[model samples]
Target: MPDASPTLGEAGAASVSPTAVLTIYIPSEAPQDKVTRAIDAILAAHPWEVPVIEVSETRLVMCG
Candidate 1:
């Protein structure tokens, strides 16, 4: 399941703690190269210290 937990950032916090968790999704139908580039750009722009980033159909869940 995707992360349905409430997040501090989403609650309008001024800053996110280093341990805050976030979820992102890329639909399977999306272009692979575009997905790669988009993820790369996100990494370049932010200092996300996530321990793991899984990209598979099993975890391809997203909420509208």
Candidate 2:
């Protein structure tokens, strides 16, 4: 007997992938303490134990 599994071209054959993006905004007038806490919270919630962190004058990016 032949196997029953359908080929990639069949209906429901292709799998769907998921993605997530996080963006943080810091105002020019925001306090340093508040900014620190916000960044800390973001790092704490990230999945990676040691995420690669990068920053510029305006933004921060964290990648695992």
Candidate 3:
């Protein structure tokens, strides 16, 4: 049987599956301890882990 999965040209088909973006904008004047705890909590909530091969200033290169 042919696959029922949506192809690239289909509407609402996300180019990257299971995508997430983490963006935090704590003011520079915020307390260090509070900021640290907030960041820790956010990270703890999303516990998914991937095997990253390299990390740079701009991007993360994950292992295939």
| lDDT of every model, 2 decimals | 0.60, 0.61, 0.52
- The runs of at least 3 residues in candidate 1 whose Cα sits more than 4 Å from the true structure, single-residue gaps closed, are 1-17, 48-51, 59-64
Runs in model 3 with CA error above 4 Å? 1-17, 50-64
Better of 2 and 3 by TM-score: 2
Best by lDDT: 2
- RMSD (CA, Å), each prediction: 11.5, 13.3, 12.7
Best-to-worst order by TM-score is 2, 1, 3
- What range of 10 consecutive residues in model 3 has the weakest lDDT sum? 47-56
> Could you say which candidate leads in TM-score?
2
Candidate 1 residues 1-64, lDDT tens each? Answer: 1333334344333554665455676777888899999878767765534334566664546899
Model 2 worst lDDT window (10 residues) = 1-10
RMSD of 3: 12.7
Identify the superior model by lDDT, candidate 2 or candidate 3. Answer: 2
For model 2, residues 1-64, the per-residue Cα lDDT tens digits are 1333432234435544343666656787889899889889878887644455555467557899
- Model 3 per-residue lDDT tens digits across residues 1-64: 1333443334445354554565555666778899778866765675333222232234457998
Query: Candidates ranked by lDDT, best first?
Result: 2, 1, 3
In terms of TM-score, how similar is model 3 to the real structure?
0.44
Look at candidate 3 and give me any clashing residue pairs.
none
Each model's backbone clash number: 0, 0, 0
